[model samples]
Target: MQTIVIAGGGVAGLELATRLGRDLGRRNKARIVLVDSAPTHFWKPLLHSVAAGTIDPSHYHVDLARQAIDNHFEFLCGEVVDIDRAGRTLKIRARLPHALGHESVLRYDRLVLSFGSVTNFFGVPGAETHCLSLDGVEQAEAFRRRFLRLCAATSGGAPRVNIVIVGAGPTGVELAADLRHTVDTLVRYRLNSLESPCQVRITIIERGPRLLPTLAPALSEAAARKLRELGIEIRTNTAVSAVTAEHVTTADGEVFPAAIAVWAAGVQGPAINTRLGIALNRNKQVLVDEQLRAVDDPFIHAMGDCSAMQVSDSTAMVPPSAQAARQQAIFLHRLLAGIERAAIPVFRYRDQGTLVSLGEYGAVGMLRQVIGDRYLNVQGAMAKAAYRVGYERYVMANLGPVRMFAQMLVRWARSRWLMPVKWH
Candidate 1:
């Protein structure tokens, strides 16, 4: 039997493991094992919300071990340290210190790497070492802790809770809106008129000409307008040369004072990809061909944010988004059933438009017509409704429709009877 090992149980990886497990492992046709550094999985898009304390991540986390049992696969918790391509082996380290102190060397007949990406600091001074990032749950929780402390510090007086976000992409924009929502929620619950109006000021700095650079121009304009109406500041065409403890200095010599600095400017594949003896782009993404196999080795496949699969007919590379990752997972599930390197099919990513949530205030997104090339530009109620539906669809994909409905009911009950996790 071919032993198929998938690393990094992110969105694409988890879904792939489940599908492959049900198809192959259940039938006793193959051995399927999933490896991840984390014991649980939370959708990456919600990291900003988690950081803002609008939602608790633990409530949404899908336990990998539970998933493995239900899906008929095996789960190993580890950080894959090295790939011995000649030996067809993986060197992994225990992801948690509490686990047994041992290094594992596992061999795989087929290997898939979906390890995802990390925050890219662009080598800007202090960006990597100093700024907080929303790349993972721990980091998001850390930011939330600091934010709550800032609110606590302003118990009886006005405090300027200044935040400098060094990117104006979806993560940055979403974070700004959610942070504002968090402060507003705190004001309503903990801070009364006897106190100040949260004293929170957020500034988004982007080197690009506009926010959401890859999005439709009209949609970007709409999002920017909405943000401004909510009293959030935007600085376009502004580049950060360096970050300091108290301020982020612009390339043009201006400085923005910040109580907390966040780095959401860009992303690149994890550093381990560079040492894998495969061809990696400057961004550290494994350069894959049409079939999603590493250019150097057919046994090695890379997916999601870690794989730079070039567009079949265009110069543009596949953008790192949950939509793309989901599409890839579905495509690969059908293609990898044979578990062979021959007669592989190329992956063609579908464009499903974009959705950028503006916290509770509202949302903005452009939905594409499945029948045509046009887009349905959406905002306000329509966009907000669509946003919720998008998440529901994801839940349905991961947990099935019946479980999704039950989960939705639980969330409604919690919101009705219990205060938000921030209060706890």
Candidate 2:
């Protein structure tokens, strides 16, 4: 039987591992091994919510060992250090307690690389050390701690809190809204006071001319209006030239003092991708063929944010998104299931839609394709409900129905229990 090893254990890698483990491992045709740095998995998209205390990580994370047993796959907790393509082997840095580490080399009959991307700081001065990011659980927790400390220190002193978010992308907007909601709740509980006489100051800085630059201009405008209505300051056509401990210096030389600075400007492929000798695009995303195989190596496959695949003649490459990563996983799974290499179909991306959540009661986006057109624009409460349903559907699809229902129940219970407890 052939042995298949998948690196990352993120959304794409875990899904692939579960499907392949059941289909191939159950039949005794192959062995599937899923490796990741962490022992548990958390959806990357919800890191912002976690940071803002809008969601708890305990209810959202899945233990890799338990998931592996349920899905019929072997789970390994270690970070991949190097890949020897010629030798069909990879080195993993074993994580042992109280020691630097010993290396373990694992050979694979087939390999799938889906080690996902990381936060890209763009080398802005002080951006790395000064600004807070919601890249993973650790960063989110750190941000949450800092947020609590700031609130405690400023209680009854400032009329409002000043939070500056650098980026007008989905993460930034969602985080800003979530943070606003959190502050609102905190104020109602008398946990913190706003610095201003009237309202809390939440600023979103964007280098582009409008918010949600990837979306339609009309949608972006609507989102901006909605955010403003919620007391958020949308600063478009602004670039953060540098970040300091106390303030952010813009390209126009405007300095804004903020209690907290969030960097969600952009992201790029992980450092390991650059060292793999694979062909990467300008953004450092590994370039993959239509079949999702690395351009330079047929035996190795790359997916998720770490990969760039061309979907159409006009479009240069597919955008790094969870939807794209999920589709790529499905396509690769089909190919691995005995479909002839040459006969395997090329990847075609399906743009379902995008939804940017605004606080608890609001969201903006489009949905339902207009026949030949791929884009859809939706707004108001209808859009918000649709977004929630879409997220539930995604959770149900990735995690089985039982686990999904349990998660919902747990969330409801947590909300009831934690709402009255003041962290400060």
Q: Which one wins on TM-score?
A: 1
Q: Give the per-residue lDDT of model 1 (tens digit) for 1-424.
A: 8899999899899999998999999998889989998999999999999998888787788899998998888999998999999999999888777775568899999899999999989999998877999889999999989877776776456658789999999999999999887777777776433254538889999999999987789989989998888789999999999998989999999999888999999999998998898999989999888778899999998899999988888889899999898888878787778644547577888788888899888888889987998888888888889888988888788778898999889888877886654643
lDDT of all the models against the reference?
0.87, 0.82
For model 2, residues 1-424, the per-residue Cα lDDT tens digits are 8889999988889888888887887788899999888888888877888888888787788888898888788988888999998999989986545433777899998889888887788888988888998868999988888887777666444545578999999999999888878877777776654443234578999998999977889999988887888778888999898998888889999998877899999888888888888899877888988888899999888889888888777565677777778888888887887643665478888777778887584889867586876666788878888877876766786678988998889878877878732254
329: Cα error in model 2, Å: 0.9
Give each model's clash number.
0, 12
The alpha-carbon lDDT assigned to residue 170 of candidate 1 equals 92
RMSD in angstroms, candidate 2? 2.3
- Clash count in backbone of candidate 2: 12
